[model samples]
Target: MNKDNENLVKSYRLLTVWLLSLFILAGIFSVLLIRLDLNLSSKVTTLFWLCFVSFYFISLLLMIYKTERVYYINYITHKEAQQATKEERRAFAYKHLIVFCIATFIFVIYSIVSLIFQYPAAVDFAVFIVIIIVSALRTVPFKLKE
Candidate 1:
């Protein structure tokens, strides 16, 4: 098979696996929400919703990162991976940074609301850290071996 075709197959596999994982996560959270009556208060509800939204967004970002990596690798295999023009790569990196910033901003708003509602900082930070790590990883450039 051609490199492009192989890359397409890999992307499909990743998407399928990630989508399944997300569905399972949603199911678990839904059960928790129902069993514990987690949305009884404004604070608890805000925190819950924040967590739900953050997880979905981060999952999407990770999926994009994975897809981009596949594209990069496939381009290299096909000898189509030109040395990225400085401005082009910089702009791409900047765009990812902007996305991270937007996600962090939303998290901050949720954290403030959560704190006001007596939610724990530890819980907030734990979720925030995951976002930070994923965003940070996405910004790094990967070199390919010949």
Candidate 2:
């Protein structure tokens, strides 16, 4: 198999892993809270969500760095990438970054609103589901550099 194709698959695989991990993390948090019979204040729940989102963003940054190095900057600048155009590679990066930013921004907004309003206990789980769905739906085709 071609190296570029392999790298593209790896990126998508990592993305799926990231989304699933976040979803599971949120689910477990909810289950544990209930099972432990711990009463959490609204402020505490908000704080928990804020911390979770911070960790998610950090992990996502790491994944983006790894995939960007493999596909956009390092791979495209290599000898085997002679057929790849720099402009196109950069455009791919720019577009995906924008999508990531916008999706995360909207999610954060919804989370804040829900938390402040003291929504149902399912809010966190719902947020996780939305995030996973959004990310999965946004997965781009694994285009390889020719």
Top candidate, metric lDDT: 2
lDDT of 2 by residue, 52-134 (tens): 77558646755554455324322234333333444444445555555556666666676677677867656656775667567
RMSD of each: 9.1, 7.6
**lDDT of each candidate versus the true structure:** 0.56, 0.58
Say which candidate scores most in TM-score.
Answer: 2
Residue pairs with backbone overlap in model 1: none
Candidate 2, residue 71: lDDT: 48
Off by over 4 Å in 2: 1-67, 70-83, 141-146
- Error at 114, model 1, angstroms: 7.2
lDDT, residue 96, candidate 2: 52
